[model samples]
Target: MTWRLVRYELAMIRRNRHAWWTLLTLAALALLSFANLSLEAARANADKREVAAAERERWLGQGEKDPHSAAHYSIFAFKLSPTLATLDSGIEPFVGQSVWLEAHHQNDMLDRPQQKASLLQRAGLASPAGLILTFAPLVAFLLAFVAVAQDRERGTMRLALGASAHPRTIVRAKTLAIWGGMAALLVLPLAALALMVAAIGGRLDTDILLRVMAWTVLMSAYLALLAGIGIVVSLRAPNARIALVLLFALWIAMALVLPRTASSAVDALRPLPSSQAVRQQMLDEAAAYWTAEDTKRHQAQLLARYGVARLEDIPNARMAELDMVERHSHQVFDRVLGALYGRVADQDRLFSGLGFLSPTVAAQSLSASVAGSDFSHHHHFIVSAERYRRDLVNAMNADGMAHRADSNERHINDVRLWSAIPEFTYPEPTLGGTSGTAIPALVALALWLLAVTFLVDRAARRLMP
Candidate 1:
């Protein structure tokens, strides 16, 4: 009986011209979004390679300089797009793409693509993930809101009740039919994305793919919950129009207003200091720590630590070597600034925690996490980049200390040393990392789905004879 009902519902939907047109419009939009992302990815990849190659050439061509001087010169590492990044884009478009790595002081990533793009691009060019996570649920709500209401309006509810078809079964069939349509709208583009990645020789981690798929499933569940809520509204309201207006109000609150409001609240409560402020503080601390009087004492301590009675007595480039120590001191100051920045980030997380009240917010956050486009994933890339910078700079500094002259030589000329520095390569976080960060949102989504399911069942029982 449920299967018959589902078939009937599918037939009814297929016969509706408006429904077909809506589906076609959604598919076309998804395809267009995918194409845009693909083009952006291609352009970004080309730019990265070109910049990297140019930097490498410049590094190789530098005049012979003390290893310490070379370390100070630094290099840049550009963030690469992850295999699934084109599908989501997330905050990546808003964040900088590259970081400068020197002996001391970590620079924040720079160049937000969103800031460079036009206003219309930012507002209307919905990411593929946005369409799936935000729009699909609304579509589901529209389809299911009139499921039982239309029956009641047409006097079919009486016929259905008399046919001995349980309301639960009827609702279940209708939900399944709507679910099928929503899934098609959501998954087709994602599947195409997977194929595109495969065709491009992109490395897709199985774990990450699974997490992405899980996010899609959760999104489907969220839509199911909305559909159930819509049915309840339909059953309670006097007309389909009223049910739709009520659903739209709920949608606006959940999908549009709540997440932004939560983020704004978090920023208000735990504001992040400007990047300029952070850099200025580091500079002030370095200047104060490297005063002439303090420098003499610091150099004395370095000589003592190396078991040398005088700076000149030490083998290798002692003055050149002291530069490395100064660089490390600057790095310590950077660490302090980084800690301050992290505190503000914790506050932002607390703000996002408020999304548990809205399933749309929860699902959107979870989907981005699973798709590796959330804040945590972005931070992961940043942390990794910093670590690489430290390693590369330290290696250059150590080389200078081991090979440069011990005398107060202002510079050690060594072009080869510059050529030896390793370039930065950003390794994207695995799916596990993204999924782990998204756990809170996923839990929230699950609870909401369960709550809605229970409510729908209770409501159906009330309607039963």
Candidate 2:
């Protein structure tokens, strides 16, 4: 009987021209977004790799020069894109592509994707995960909002009840039909999209396949929750119009407003200091720590320690002072940047805390984490880059000290020495790392779905017998 009811609902939906059109329009839009993303991902990765290779060759081919000069000619550490990011570019647009690893200083990554976008692209840039979370639920709601209430209004509900059919069973069939319809419209198109991406050499490896499947399951759950909400509204409202109005209001609150409000609240509660300001403070500290008087004192100490009368007689004198300055600068950067890292982590945690109030927040968080564009993944890459910079700079400084001599001696090394420095390599984060960061949001979403399902069942039972 339930199967027959479900089939009846499906057959009725097949006759709704407007619903079918809506599905078509949505699928078209999704394909456009994915197409841009697939090409862009391939191009961006290619450009980054190409530029990195050129830079590496440039470094190795830079002819013999002073170690200090070579240190200044720093290489860039390029971050490659993870395949999942093509589906949902989370925080990637906001962050930079590469960090310049140089001697004697730490650098923030530079050249974000957002930096290259025009005013219009910035305004309407679409994310697949974002689009699905925002609009798919609305599509589901539009289909199911009238599922029960319209039957009641038209008096078919009387026939349904008179047939000795349980209201719960009737509601279940309606919900199942609604969910299946939307899944067919949304999920099937996306599955086709995945295949197309693979055909275009998007590397549908095991990891990427796993992420796509996970994203699909998440979308399914979110849509199911929305469908249940719509059905519940339909069961409780006096008529279809009222059910739609209520559902629309809920959708606006959940999809449009809450996510922004939560993020803004986190920023307000734990404001971060400006990066430029922190850099300035580090500069001032370095200046104060290495004043003229301090340099003179250090020079005298080096002279006394070496038992030399004049600066020219002391070997490695300049290198010793550089060594001292480098150590002090490192300490300053570590202290200032460490504080900034802490503030960012705090903000991320606060935003994660608000996931229960807004499933969109949870969904975005999960998508970003899985795609390796979240704060955690980016931070790890940044930390790794900085570590590499430190090692590279320290090696150069050591070479400086080794080649140091009196003022007349000029220190230079063979260009082949550059090849000895290992290329910067950033490891792709593992699935476990993604899961760790996404777990909180995942849990929040599960709780929401469970809560909605419980309410829906209760509402279904309360419908007229």
Candidate 3:
């Protein structure tokens, strides 16, 4: 009986020209998004390689600079594109891609791609992920909002209920059919993306494939929730139009208004200081502290901990060695900056925590996280870049310390040392790592799915008569 109803529902959807047209439109949009992503990914990869080559040339060109001077003239490292970044772009386009690793302060990533793009990119184009995760679900809502109400208005519900078919079975069949259509709309574009990536010599990870599958399941579940909500509204409302209005209002609240409001509230509650301001303040404080007598005593203590009797007695070479020590002092200042930055990130996490109240937000956040497009993913990139910076600077400083005997020594310049330094490389984090960070959002989605399923069952029983 359920199979019969499912077949009937599928046939009904196929016969609806509007539904077919909407699905076709969605498929077209998804394909376009995939193309855009592939183009952008190719561009980003090319840019990264170019920058890396330029850095290599510049380092090798530094004929015979002292190792300490090389440390002070550290190279910039660009973040590499993740395999799945093309699908979602996420914060990659908005955040800076490259970091300058000079001797002192850890520089923030600079040159946001979004700043170079047209304004429309900021509002969001119909990216494949966005179409599936966002727009297609809305399209499903449009299809389902009048699924039962139209039948009732036309007396089909009464006729069906009078037959041997159970109302619960009827609702389940309807949901399954609509969900099938939604899945196709989503999967077609993703299949195209897979093909495009394969054609471009990109390697796809099994974990990424699994993440995409999970994302698909989440999207389908969200559509099911919307379908269930639509049925309940249709059963309760007097007419199809009212059912749509109610569903639209619900969609607005969940999909549109709440996420932004929560984000705004979180910002107000825990404001983050600008990166520029943070950097400037750290530099000022470091200068003041280094100059102060009490601060000098503290430095003396640090040097003592390192088993050094005096600054000159410390086993190091020239003015360059002194510069390296000054650089280490700046590193201490950066630690203070990192603590403050962590506080702000904690506040952002607190905001993301509210995803429980809105499943749309939860699904969106979880999808992005699993795909490595979330803020945490970007943060990991920045942190990785910083680690590389430290490595590069330390390598150069070690050479400086070995070559020069005292702060007064004019060191021999050896450009060969500069060429030997390793170029920075960025490794994209795994989906498993990012998904672990997204468990809360996934749980929230599960709870909402359960709640909607329960409500659908309850509503079906009530509407049976």
Per-candidate TM-score against the hidden true structure: 0.90, 0.90, 0.89
Q: Tens-digit lDDT track for model 2 on 277-369?
A: 987887787753467788898788778877889877755677766766777778988888888887887777677767899887887787677
Alpha carbon lDDT of residue 332, candidate 1?
66
When summed lDDT is taken over every stretch of 10 residues in candidate 1, the lowest stretch is 315-324
lDDT of candidate 1 over 216-272, digit per residue (tens):
676668767777777677766777678778878877777777877877877888787
What does candidate 3's lDDT look like per residue over 4-56, in tens digits?
88778878877878866887788788777777777787788788889889987
Which scores higher on TM-score, 1 or 2?
Answer: 1
Model 1 regions more than 4 Å off: 316-327, 330-334, 404-416, 434-436
Best by TM-score: 1
lDDT of 3: 0.70
Q: List per-prediction Cα lDDT, in the order shown.
A: 0.69, 0.77, 0.70
Give the top-scoring candidate (lDDT): 2
